[model samples]
Target: MATGAESGRRLRVGLLGTGGVASKYAALYGEYPRSLLVALHDPFDPGAGELAARFGGRVAASVEDLIASDIDAVVISTPNPLHLAQASAALKAGRHVLLQKPMTVTLAQAEELERVAEDSGKVLALYMNSLDNPVFRDLRRMITEGVLGKVGSINCKLANGMGHVWRNRPANFWRGSRAAVGGGSFAMLACHYLNLAQWLLDQPIIRTTAIGTNLMCDHIEGDDLMSAIVEFAGGELGVIEAAWCVKGEQMSLHGSAGSFAYIDNSVVTMKADSPFIGEAIRYETPGTRVVLDGLLAPAMSDWTNPYNQHRCFVDAMLDGTPVPMPAGKGVQDMRVLDAAYRSSAGAVHVAVHVAIHVADDGAVAEAVA
Candidate 1:
C-alpha cells in the first residue's frame, strides 16, 4: 500500500481490469489521502506496477494474486460480463468491492454475486457513480423531506450526441450487445434514471411498458434509443428517453410540482423547480461531485466525477456500517431493467416488487411496485 511518511496507513486497493471504468476508479481513488491503488490485475496492461510507482503500491500478476495481497478493498472495473466473476472472487477472498454498474446484465448473475457477498458478510457496493453527485444527494433529500410533493410523474431524457459510448465510441457500443450488456439503452443509461427514479419517488416501479431500437447507431445491435413508462407503487408514472441522438448532451427531470435541468454536462443544476412551481432551489452538488471537481469545489461550484461511492464502500467495510447502494441494490436495479425489457418485448406491463413512498406530508408509505 502507499505509505505516507510515518503515518504508515493507507487503504489498500486491488484493482482488477484496466479499462475506461477502472481508469476512472484509479483517478478518483488516487485523490483520497488514506487510499492507495496498491495492487492491480490487468493482463492487457499491468499499469499496477507503474501505478504503484505513482501512488506507492505493487502490481499483482493476476486477480487471484491481488486477492492474496493484503489489500483493504477491490475495485472490479472489468468488462460487463466479468463483474460477477471478479467480484465473487474478491468477496470470497475477504475483500470489500466496488463493482462497476449494470451490476450484471442478468438477474441470476446479480443474485449469485449478492449471495456471495451476503454469505461472506463483506461490503459489496455498486458504482452508480452519478448518484454520488451532490446534486443527486440533495435531490433525494428534498424528495424524502417532501420538498417535492406526491411526485405523480417523472420525465427523464439523456442525449448521448455523437460522443463515444465509453469514450469516442457510440452510446451502448459495448452495452448494445445482449451477450455482453444484457439490455440496450434501458440497461446501460436508463438504469441511472431508474435508480434516481426510485430514490426520488422513494417508491418502486409498480408496472412498466417500453419500446427500444438501435435507430441511429447503425452498427450497434441493441437499442440506441429507448422510451419507457414506469408506474411506481403509488401509481406514480415515470417516462424515460435515452439515445445517442443529440450531437452533444443533455439531461432533465420533471416532477409533480418541480423540475430540474442540467446543462453543459455539469451535475450542478442550472434550474430547479420547487414543489410549488416556479419557486427555485439553488443547486447543491452531490457528494461524489463535491470531491471530484477538485480544489475548485469549495468556491461554491459543483464537484463531480470522483469515485466517492467506492470510497463509501471502503469505509463501510472497514467500519462495518451499512450504507445504501450495496451490490444487492445494483442487482435489483438490473432486475427492474430486465422487467422493463420484458415488458417492452411482450407488449405488456411488468410489475416490480420493491417500493418505498414518502408522502408530501412526510409520512413513509411503503409497498411492492
Candidate 2:
C-alpha cells in the first residue's frame, strides 16, 4: 500500500477486460497522475492487444498472469458472470478492485464476493459513477438542507432506443441474451436508478412489486422493458421505469413543501405554500454536462464526474479513506433487484429481507434472506 506521504507515487493498475467500457476507463487514466495503467488482460487476445496499444499497457496472457503482476489495483470490466471470479481472485491476491456495475448477477454471488473482499482487507468499489452527476449532487444537498421538505415520493424513468438498434444485430445480440447478460433491461439499466434512489433518499427499499417482459425485439431472450413499484423504509414511494424501447429520461421527487423534477437535462423545483409557490425555478445543465453514455463514458465537466470517481478510489487506497461505493451497497442494490425479480415472477409483492452490518474494521457483512 502506498503511504499518504507518497502522493506522488502512482498506483499500478491492470485492466481485466479490453471491451468498450474498459477502453473508456483506460482513456481516463491520463487524467489522474496517481493512476497508471500497467497491464491488460482479456480472453480475446486481439482485443487485449488493441486496448494495450491504445492505452499504454502490456497485454497479459491471462487473468492469473495479470493478478500475479506487480499491480496495486485491478479494474474488472469483464462480463456480468465473470465479475465474481475475477474480482475474488484479484482481492485474494491482495489487489484492490474497481469493479463495473451490477457487481454480480445474483445476491448470492454478491454476498460471497463481499466476504472475500472483507477478508482480503482490500478496497472493493463498485463502479456506479452516475452518483457523480452534479445534478444529483445538488438535489441531494437540497434534500439534506430541507429545501424539499418532507419528501414523500420519487418517480424515475430511463429509456433509450437501443433495443431497436440491437434488435436484430448479431454483434449486440449477446446483450439481449439472458444467459450472457443475466437479467433484462432492469439489470442493464434500472440498476443505475435503483442505486441512485438509495443514495439520494438515503433509504432502503423494503418492499417491491414489479413486472418485466420482452414486449419487442424477438432476437433476445431477456425482457426489453421493466417497471417496479417500491416502498422505502421511510414511507417514501418510488416508481421506477426502465426500457430500451423508449426515447428519453426523467425523474421527479415530491415533497410536502416542495417538488423537484429532472427531465432530460433540466431541473425544476417548486415550493408549495411558500414565497416560491406556483413559481417553478428551473436550472438546465448544458448538453455537454450530461454523460451521454451514462456511466459508460467519461464526464466532460470536472464536477463529480467519472474521473472523480476513479480518482477517489485511487486516493482511498493511498490515504486509507472509505471507498465511495462499497461492495455492501452493491449487495444491497442486488438484493432489492432480487426482490423485484421474485415479485415479478411470483406475481406478488416481495419484502426485501437483506441487512447490512458494518464491522469495526469497516468491513461489511450482509444477512442472508
Candidate 3:
C-alpha cells in the first residue's frame, strides 16, 4: 500500500478484461498521468493484445499473471458472473479492485466480495459511474441545500433500442444470459437509476413492487421491459421504468418547494411561487457529449463525470481516502435489484429487508436480511 505522500510515482494498473468496457477504462487510464495501465489480461489473446497496444501496456498471459504483477490496482470489467472471483482474487493478492456494475450476479457473491474487501483492508469500488454525472451531482446538491424542500417523489425512465441489436447477436452474447448477467434491463440499465434514486433521495427503498417481461427480444433469457415502484423510508415514492424497446431517457423529482426534470440529460427547474418572477429555467448540456468528450480527451478532466469518478478512485487509493463508491454501496444496490426481481417473479410487493441506521457520528449502518 503506497500512500500518495510515500510514492510520487504513478500508480500501476492491471486491466483484468479487455472487453468494450475495459477499453473505455483503458482510455481513461491513459488520460491520468498519476495512473498507468501496466498490464492487460483476457481469455481472448487478441482482445488483450489490442488493448495493450492501444493503451501502452503489456498483455499478461493469464489472470493469475496479471494479478501477480507489480500493479497496484486491478480494474475488473469482465462479465457479472466473473466479478466476484476476479475482484476477490485481486483483493486477496493485496491489490485494490475497481469492479464493474451489478457487482455480481447474486447477493451472496456481493456479500462475499464485500467481506473479502473489508478483510483485505484494500479499496474495492463499484463502477456505478452515473453518480459522477454533473447534472446528477448538481441535483443532489440542490436537494441537500433545501432547494427541493422535502422531496416527495421521483420518476425515472430509460428506454433504449439496444435490445433489438442484442437479440440479433450470437447466443453467446454475455449480456443476454440471465445466468451470466443477472437480470435484463432492470439489472443492466435500470440498476443505474436505482442507485441514482437512492443517491438523490438520500433514502433507502423500504419496499418494492415490480413487473418485468421479455415482451420484445424474446431470444434473451431475461426481461427486456421492467417497471418497479419503490417506497423510501423517508416517505418519498419512486417509480422506475426501463425497457430495451423504447428509445429515450428522462427523470424528474417533485418536492414541496419546487420540481426539477431531466430530459435527455438536460435539466429544467421550477420553483413553487413564480408570479412570472422566478419562472422555470432550463440548462442545456448534452450528457452524451459530456461523456464522449471525457472519453476522447487526452487527459482526465474533473469536469467530466466519468473521468472524475475514475480520478476519485485513483486519489482514494493513493491518498488513503475513502472510496467514492465502496463495495458496500454495490451490495446495497444489489439488494434492491434482487428485491425487484423477487417482487416481479412473485407478483407481489417485496419488503426490502435491509435496515439502514444512521449513527450519531453520521456513519451508516446497514443490516441486510
Candidate 4:
C-alpha cells in the first residue's frame, strides 16, 4: 500500500460543516498541497454550497453521500451532539476522521468513537489546534522536561462575550441549547485549556470541584460562567475558569524550580532558577491578536503557517504517521469536563479515573481518560 505522499497523490477530503470553524479549515485544505477539499455537506447550513465553491469541492447531498464519495478523509466540524454519529459513519466507511473539539457530549460517546477509530485502524485526530503553537510546545517542553521542575499548580482562564449573543439567538442555534452542545462556554471552550494543562503536566486530571451558573445569559440552557478546581494524578492542583460572559485568556504554571505564564495567549514569559534557564525569558508570536473566538482564531488569517495543525493533519495522512493530536487527548479532556459538570450539579467533588492502554507497538490504542 503506497502512502498518499509516496505516490504523489493528494488526499481527497470531505468537509462535514460550513460554519466559521469549518470555513477556516476549508481555507486551509484549499491551500494545503497534499490534501484537496473534494466535497462538503451541511444539511442545515445553506453556506455549505458556497464553501464548496470557494474551496474547490462539490456540495455533498448528505453526510452519507460525502462519505461514500471519492474521499479518503473526513473533517467533522458539526455540533457536539452529531459528532459521534458523523465520525463513526465516516470512519466505518474507510475514511480518516479529523474531529473538532469537545469530542462528544458524553463520556460514552467519546469512548465509543475511540473504539471505532481503534478498530478501523484509521486516523481519528482531534482539532485542538493550539497544540501546534511553538510557544505552547515550548511551555510543555519546559514543564515536563523539568525546567519548571515538578509543577505544583496551574491556573488558566478562557472566556469570551459570546453569551450576550447566545441570549438572543434563535432556538435553532445549536450552541445555546445544553442538550445540543453539552454545555455552554465550558464544554465549548474549556476542553482546550483542560487538555493543554494536562499535556503540560503530562498528568491525568483525577478529580474536580466545580460551580457553574447562568449568571449572564438568561435564555441559554447552559451555564455562562464556570470555575473548577481540579486535581492531577500526581497531586498537582489546577484552577480553571471558562465563561461566555467575559473576555480573557491567560494561564500560569508554578513549579518547584520556576514559573511560567502567558497572557492573551500571545505573550509567553517564563522564569527558571534551573540550569536550563537561569533568567527570565519572554516569547511572543508577532501579528497575533486577542480574539473573542478560541485559539484557532489567529490561525485563520494565516493557515499556511508552517505550525498550523491542519498541515500536521494532512502530513500525517499522506505519510502514514501517527496522529499529531490523538483522540485519546480529547477523551481525557472530555473526562475532565464531564467531572466538572457533574461536580457543579451535585455541589460536590467528583472523582475521575482514566484508563489508558498502551499497545506493544508503544502507541496509545485505547483510552477512556
Better of 1 and 3 by TM-score: 3
Ranking by TM-score: 4, 3, 2, 1
C-alpha-based local distance difference test score of model 2: 0.78
State in Å the error of residue 148, model 4. Answer: 2.1
Pairs in steric clash, model 2: none
Estimate, for each residue in 186-229, the C-alpha lDDT of model 2 and write its tens digit.
88788888999998999999999899988876677677888999
lDDT of 3 by residue, 1-369 (tens): 767757787778998877665677787776676788899888854676776777778888889999999999998878788888888999999999988887899888899999999899888998777765666666777688776678899999988879898767999988889888788888888878888898787888888889999987888889899999999989899999888877888888888766777776543444432111121232233121111112121222342444367777877878888877888888888898999999999874566799899999999999996
| Candidate 4 segments exceeding 4 Å error | 274-298, 301-303, 349-369
| lDDT, ranked from best to worst | 4, 3, 2, 1
How many pairs of residues collide in model 1? 16
Residue runs of model 2 more than 4 Å from their true location after superposition: 5-7, 44-51, 265-307, 348-369
Candidate that scores best on lDDT: 4
Kindly provide the TM-score of model 3 when superposed on the true structure, using C-alpha atoms. 0.83
Residue 181 of model 2 has an lDDT of 67
Q: Higher lDDT: candidate 1 or 3?
A: 3
lDDT of 4 at 171: 73
Off by over 4 Å in 1: 1-9, 46-49, 162-176, 245-256, 267-307, 348-369
What is the model-wide C-alpha lDDT for candidate 4? 0.82
The candidate with the higher TM-score, 2 or 3, is 3
